[model samples]
Target: MKISDIASISDAQKFILDLYPNDNRDFSYVFGYATRHLGYLCKSLCKNSPSVEEFIRSISWLLALANKLEVDVEVSLIKRHPDICPYCVVAPCKCRWTGKKPAIGIKAYKIPEELFYRAEQIKREKKADFQSHCERLAIIYPGNAYKWDAIGPWQLTSKMQEELAEVHEAATRYLSGRKSIDAVAEEFADLFAWLLSAWGLSFPEGNVDDSFIEYYLAGCPVCGNNENCECELFADLSTQLVDSDKIKELEKLFLALSSEVGFDGDEVSEVLQSLEAASKSQSEPVARAAVDQAKAKTEELEKLVERGAKNAKNATTIAQAIYKAIENFPFVG
Candidate 1:
């Protein structure tokens, strides 16, 4: 399950379906996981590498939840956005800057005659990949990076949280028959824009498509499996269920990526060895220490990228995500 396999929204949805089939998971479960990763993503907003990795995870879970609900993400995006603001019906929306006083005689939610042709044209276009999807949002609402810079990452993350709440509100409305599913999809599309903005602001070095592919190259970051993760479902975090085989698989991935990041493969192997050994330890303190070591190592490697190490950006993104997953592992005291 490489990133290319899930480049477009439709592709990503299918990739998620392949990894975690709808029949095996319920909507609530999938939504819970999505929100859970979204929470982690928020925490990493100020950190570029970790945030990019978490963004990929968060979006993947969101796609999974959409699949469980039988939502057509690509179609929803097209209908709600249409290469322009759904409300403003114009590219590079001026609603905020213009104080919502759009052109006269044009009511809210109505596409004007001048823009209708372009909107219809965009709808006929093929589904775009993650990078193009984010880029489209940038086009629709330009200057997001500048806005994000002015407000700071804290405010950026806060905006993301707000959008997620709107998604919840929209979903609730649909479930209660107060709104249509299309409305819910619109909110999700907004959330996706905010999320992509967060990623673009922090990590502007490469396209999100490449970053996502790098982190998810091995499929499930935890279990290292392509389809149907072998890791215990995160249904309960209090339980201790460390799988040594999965740990070894993660270690192998780290080793394979060491040279790509200009890091010593032996050092990378040693860090995971400690993590593997600690996962088997009876003392909670030992596992906690190993988690810290892995985190410190991840940070050090990221610093190497900061120091201009070749190709470290792609490799360290995966390293950050892997360590974050380890830190959040269901380690019991």
Candidate 2:
């Protein structure tokens, strides 16, 4: 498959779902895995590791969350950033020159039939890399923060963690019957935006070490099938598998931390159950609820920055637990 066809947000989601056909993992697990890979990306950057595998993995999880939540990633992106900077309404982005805030609720100009086409147009028009795209997006949709200032990689990673926590909380609320899935989807979108920002920061030259499409072009990386994969050993056997005992230990640690932090365990498990159900059946209502829940969570987090910080820390712990559980399982397919 061509990169253009496979790399579109929709196609990527389908490809990932196909590789893990039996996946009934919850939204928390998905978000947790994504966050974990992002944390790895941050580690690689900090340690000056040349590998980009973690970046690709992180992006994959974000795309998977987008699929699970039924969010149109392409639409979300293009709407905020078209051919020109949505803020300055200029190709070269005159936001700094104009010293004015981005116009509110502006629509995208020249939306293409395919998201890939739009991406290419953006590349040509701006001569920008992945990181630049993120910067432009921050300018266009500053959210409620009022100002669009340059943030360093560390800050970007921190923001990414914050968004991840918001998504987690939204999922928890959805399980508790206090919110809808749409709210969850919205927070997932925010998390995705931050992941993209991290991606750009990690690879400023626009050179991704691995092509997501190419990696999966032949189907499941392990089973080598587009459907009905039957690989008993899903993990990349080449890497050391995380010990099952270690995972259990980490799980206990996570539970302890969650309790200490006053997280609702019942609600978290309920959200996970709902997410698993949604994934298995692809139920429209269930997926839609998750999206609305994501949106609600985002709004709620914005209002509770201090509490959000605590939640973010908890989320990191949860993600660490998840990584311990699956770090050995390879689905690079």
Which candidate's lDDT is highest?
Answer: 1
lDDT of 1: 0.69
- 227-313 per-residue lDDT for model 2 (tens digits): 645656324323222233433343354344444455545644444454455445555565445334433333333334346555666
lDDT per residue as tens, model 1, 1-333: 445656677777787777677775666677777777787677656543354566777888888877766677776666666677755566778788666565445765555454556546765775477677677777887767677667657776787788777877877777779988877887777777788767666666768777766776777777777767666666432223465554555566566456667678666777877867865763567666766676677777777777888886677767766666675565522
lDDT of 1 at 282: 37
Q: Please list the C-alpha lDDT of all candidates, in the order they appear.
A: 0.69, 0.54
